[model samples]
Target chain A: MRYLVPLLLSTLVWWILTEAAQAWVVGVPVILVSTWVAVRLQDTDSGSAPTHRLNWFAVPRFALFFLWQSLQAGLDVAKRTLKPVPDINPGTLYYYTSIPHGTARYFFGAIVGLFPGTLCTEFSEDTDQLVLHVLDTDVDIALDCRRLEREIERLFKLPAADQQGRPA
Target chain B: MNLAFDIVLGLALLLTALGVFSSKDLFRAVVMFIAFGLLLALVWVRLDAPDLALAEAAIGAGLTGVLMIDAVAHLSANTLQNDQRDDQYDHSPKRPLWLPVISCVGLFVLLLGAIRFRPEASVSLPDMVRDNIAESGVEHPITAVLLNFRSYDTLLEIAVLLVAVVVAMALKPAAEDRVHQPPPAHDPILHGLTARLLPAMLLVGMYVLWAGSYMPGGAFQGGAILAAALVFLQLAGFAVDRYAASLLRLGLALGFLVFLTVAVSVMIGGRPFLTYPEGFAGQLIFFIEAMLTLSIGLILFSLFSQNPPHSGAVGHQGANHDQ
Candidate 1:
């Protein structure tokens, strides 16, 4: 029962990797071994770590929003760096996030760096503070971070924490 | 136009090589060396050898850079403690420039002459490979050549890798200190990236191994990707090496053992050393490659993991020290 998700995923991976039928001769053993390894690794953490449950229905919306944001941010960065004098104001901002300290918050930190002028350098779990380095400190980075946090919360269907209304 | 691009690339490659050698800071030199590897990969691509390009980029640029940076970090830390000794060592290092210049020029001339006057092979090896590729049991000529035509070479390569890894394991410092150290503080960013990227990396490694049957990918490339994924997991504070020590030892040698077993087992059927039985060649090659990928991945990861972790931390500090 513990191996179901990993086994299914590994088999799907095997199918995708080698579409040929004959490959299953070796694929079967490989998939089984891989699943065993995965299950073992998962067991290493015990029950303390939260298993992330991604809402498939929300992925498309999140991905599209992410892609658009990244494109705009990338262009903004290019413009800032390629300028004659390199117009920029760089500083750090600490974001106290409401998103819990699991995969969702971690993912939020990862993608936040891709947004225009923002880089997530550190995340303090106890404080739920995401330390961000931004190219232009003048821009309101907190607003975008809050909006993105909400987007991730929706994607994960995480229980709404009452902290969203808390001051940024 | 292509010639122009190649010439520019060639120049850039030379410049990066110079940068690597001439940089005052070891960290910068390592960075330059990485750039040199990338440019060399580009050169391989331009020469229409995507396989070499992938290997060069992954192993030469990526893995080697990390190793070298780790080494540089160790050196920096040592120098910090032995600052006076380092100054004395630096002052004593004045070798005459003309000696290297003369030797380098002589070596270049010798290489040029060798290229100009080399005799053609009596047998056209590529032609022979092309003609018999179908018999070798794989669609890709490179795969067929590697796994079938010249399998002795491949066998020896795996053996060499096994020997190298065994040596690494033997030379590693006491494991007690590392085992007792606290797990790295959980950083949401690293954990998040690992969660997302690890699966994709594993998938790509498998895809590359599978693609070797019909394209410019193979066990080596796939293995390197797998190793990179393992390294990434370790970096993210997952001590996989600690959890699966016995399994990892088996994995480290499984490919070589499997290859050797198959090679010798074939002789019992009255065929020559490595010639797979007529129709079973494809399946056998696939099986060997699958094992080889796992073994190679584990072997490479072990090499990186065997190093003391603090040496790598020192390398990080060295980068900041330079800046």
Candidate 2:
């Protein structure tokens, strides 16, 4: 029962890769072995613990939000770079994140780079601080970081109370 | 139009080669070399050799790029006190410069002569390959030639890889030096990427291995993808090598052992060495390829992993130095 999700996923991947029913001769063993390895790796890596589950229902909403933000931010950066004067203030800003450590926290870190003008460069777990290099530090990056963190928290189904991640 | 494209590609390849040779910065040279590998892969594709293209891109561009960058990082890390210069590591006594020039000119003339006066072969190699491909157990001519007609060459290639990896293992730094280094801090981004991408990589590796029976994909390409996945996991701070040491050692030699066993076992059945029994050739070849994929993947990954982490100071920045 514990291996059901990983097993199904591996089998689905195997079927897709081979696309022939006869391939199951080799696929069956490969799928089983891969699922076992996945289970083992997850067990050893605490960050990938199964407790934090992604809400599939919220994925499309998050995806659309992410894509739109990335497109806008990408253009913004491009416009700045293409200017004669190159209107930009390149500086680093440290922002404390409220998302707890693990896959969700990492997802937050990953998406922070795509947010407008900010690229997460150094993430200190002990301090819950994300050192971001921004194209224009003049903009209010805290608001954007909080909003993105909230979306990721929702996507991972963490409780609202978990926002007080490490007490500053 | 095709000729024009080829000419442009050739020029670009030469330019990248020049960039690689002329760049003062080691990092830039490595990057240019990677570009050269990609262009060479394109040339292989234009020549109608998808198999060579795949192998070249995966090994030459991808794996070699990572290795070269890792080496450059190691060099820079070791020489932090000195300015980064092209000749910082050139400690060898300077020899006569004309030695290289004469050798290069001599080799160029020899190659030109060989190409201009190449003899006509008595056998129509391609037609012969086409004729025997049916009996070789695979539809793809390259796979047929590699596994069936010229399996000895493949066997020796695997043997050579095994020897190279064994040497790497032997030359790896002492465990005590590695033990003192701090474990890389878990980066959520790299961890998440590895978590999501690993299964997909495994699937692609398997697919490429299976596709060799009918297309350009094969053990080498599949193995390289698998190795990349392993390296990704290690870079993401997973202790794959520490946990899977015994299993990895077994995997590193499985292909060669299986191939040798099959070859010798078949000889006991009054058949010649490395020749599969008539009807069982397909299954045998597939089995051999499967083992080879795993072994090759492990071997390549070992080569990368064998290098010691540069120093404890660079542990915080996990971008280049790996344990």
Candidate 3:
């Protein structure tokens, strides 16, 4: 019964799409046969977690935040480029994150990489620490990193201790 | 008035280019690059090349975005630590601002001169395509060119897709390490909505495929839509099968078989090569495209799978079907 829906749906789609060929009278049966053969040959069981439970409402918020940050980062880089002295103070720093799941961790790392001078170099799954490289090493830069960390924590709903960890 | 719009578009393109070059974040840079590709596609449309615009949107923006995102994911997984030297070097000696300024000026001047001093065409090829449009077997000029005038290029492009699949299969690690964690739980209403919409989405995909001959649909778009459906199923935890090796092989090879067989039979009919028999062109093309759609869908689904087929991993159990 579980397989029946998908099979019927696939067959219906295959028939409609091939209807224009004017050969559908013959083509539909061929496709159905092939589909059945394909299904039979497939491994009906593989142990991977299903991703059915997506947080739908958070998606738009995530997208908007990413867009705003991307724009801000773009402008920041442009300004640095236009400046005479370049004003670069580069340094690599280590920071810990409280995001437990791998997906959230990866998303956090990716979002951090969008800032003007920051690059997420490595994420240690065991320690939940991320190594980041920043072009500007000033005090303002540290504050900005903390701001980003807080934002990430807020978005992912991390614990307070992980959010307040020492900036390495 | 129209000139102002064109100027604005050009400036936007330039700004995007600058952003892509200057952005420190690699992922953002890639996203900007995709935006740049989209803008370029618009520029192509403005230049009266709708075909090029479509191709750029699909191949340039869509496919390239997928490839870049995959690359970024792989790079993030591999790099253990951020190098400190990158920051130290930023504080060192800086290049003169005049260098970039001079280069930009030089490039602009060269472009202006080239456009102003454009050469005149010497001769014109006979409009064989326009003249034979009625007899070309396809209603659309672009279709005629693709499947008739330059069929070989299209064939070779399909071959390239095959090679990509083969290469991915060859390089994939033998061990199936499933790293994709389950998505966070969502509202029951949203889940129910997704369930209801799945069937409708499949219908739309089919309609697009069927409409390709006369309209703006084709194997690629149809295939992508089908792949998305499959991806959705996988995400929804439906028909969780991970060891469908035989099915995978058949899906991957279906298009290649149909294309080859048709091409060879043309030779048997004493045609030069890949020439469809009169009154049969539409049928043959449709057959080939249908097969191609399946192949493309299967290949894309496989590429997006976290675990390779035959990895001996127990597939996820859920309400949806597996690809």
Candidate 4:
């Protein structure tokens, strides 16, 4: 039942994305089978990490923010790297996250690279932390990260971190 | 201006290729090879072959990079931890390089000579393809060629992929490649992104697959994207167990099974093998492609995964990193 909602939503998405009207006769089956395969593949023991918990209403707003930030990042990277002197200080720093260790942590690794002046170099299992390479030290990149995390928390509607440090 | 862009792209490709072959550092060489693949994709675009561009960019560059990086990580495990210099991995070839160098140069010249002196064709091939494309089921000539005009070739290609998966499974890279890796730390950023991106990526993959009927996309490109999304999930800490493994195996076999069933059914219905009935050609082809898309997606993902990749099971590292 946990997989049902995502499966149905994904199937609908699959049909529309595949332009089902072209061959309506066979379209529904194709999308359903593929979505089932996807759902099966994403089977997880960690309930808190499931994507279905996300607040769908906040998605577009988050996407816009992500896009604008990425553009800014792109421009910043281009300027610093393309300059005659390469006005940049490259260094790595650790970021401790409270999101679950599975899909959520992995998504952050990919996304952090797109953020301005910061790239996720590694996520250490022992430390429960991410190693981020930053272009500038003067900027409060951690503050930016926290802000992004706030937006993401709202979007995913992940249980707020409790006093005991476990997500509810 | 176009000529200049072409020249630059060509030069970059050549340089990257050379770097890939000649670099002493194994890591640098692999990186250069990935860059070479990206440049090759651009060259394909310049040549007006968007289908090839998409495949090259996705499979040739993206997935290949992932595989090579995985391999390098395995290789460097010993050298980095032990602080011992392994001189066995020499840059120079053990055998004389002259023979390979001479033969390659000879082949290059011969190919150049053949193209330069080739006779002009009396028949216009594009006109021929365009003329019969309507009867070929799909609107795109390339898809038509792949599915109808020369479906046997596509079948054989799927067979090749099947053989690759079977061989990989037999080789036990599946067991040694994964281990009891620690789960990822809580990361809200990743959690949020996955929630948003996975479905969207899947949608884009389907878009590409569907568009292949009329445009510059296909099962391979779409499957690569799907495989990438799954890989992202895997890297994020998703566990694959026995049940998931069997389901993935089913996905690996789905394409061939569907294709064979469709072909044999057509024969049983008194039509020639692989020839669809008059009014149902498009529907049949779409059905086959849809199955192929899932199979290809699962198979490609399994190429790197161990354990039950499709349904989520715990995996042990099969590829032993002997330091």
Fnat per candidate, as a fraction, reads: 0.26, 0.46, 0.05, 0.21
Q: Top model by DockQ, which number?
A: 2
* TM, chain A, every candidate: 0.83, 0.82, 0.59, 0.78
Task: Give the Å shift of residue A69 in candidate 2.
Answer: 2.5
Give the per-residue lDDT digits (tens) of candidate 2, residues B1-323: 99999999999999999999877566778889999999999999999999999999999999998888777777766665445553554355687889999999999999999999999899899999988888888888898888889999999999999999889888978878777777765666677677666877887898899899998998889999999999889878887767467888899999999999999999999999999999889889999999999999999999998887875332322233221
| CA lDDT of every candidate | 0.81, 0.82, 0.64, 0.74
Which residue pairs collide, candidate 1? B73-B315
Better of 3 and 4 by TM-score: 4
Worst 10 residues of 2 chain B by lDDT: B314-323
Name the regions of candidate 3 deviating beyond 4 angstroms.
Answer: A1-168, B49-55, B77-126, B176-195, B231-244, B306-323
- By TM-score, the best candidate is 1
Per residue, candidate 4 scores C-alpha lDDT tens digits across B1-323 of: 99999999999999999999887777777778889999999999999999999999988998888777666655555454544565556445579889999999999999999999999999998998999988888898888888888899988889999999888788663554455534543344554456445766877787788888888887878888888887776665554434456698888899999999999898888988888888888878877887888888888888877422221222212122322
lDDT of 2 at B124: 93
* CA-RMSD of model 3: 13.1
Q: Show where candidate 4 strays beyond 4 Å.
A: A1-84, A89-134, A139-168, B78-85, B93-97, B173-196, B306-323
lDDT tens per residue, model 3, B238-288 = 543354476887888888778888998889869977888899888788778
Instruction: Give the range of the ten consecutive residues with the poorest summed lDDT in model 4 chain A.
Output: A159-168
Residue-level error in angstroms, candidate 1, position A15: 5.6
Q: Which segments of model 2 are wrong by more than 4 Å?
A: A19-22, A47-51, A84-87, A161-168, B81-87, B90-95, B173-179, B243-245, B312-323
Error of 3 at B97 (Å): 11
Q: Positional deviation of B66 in candidate 1, in angstroms?
A: 1.8
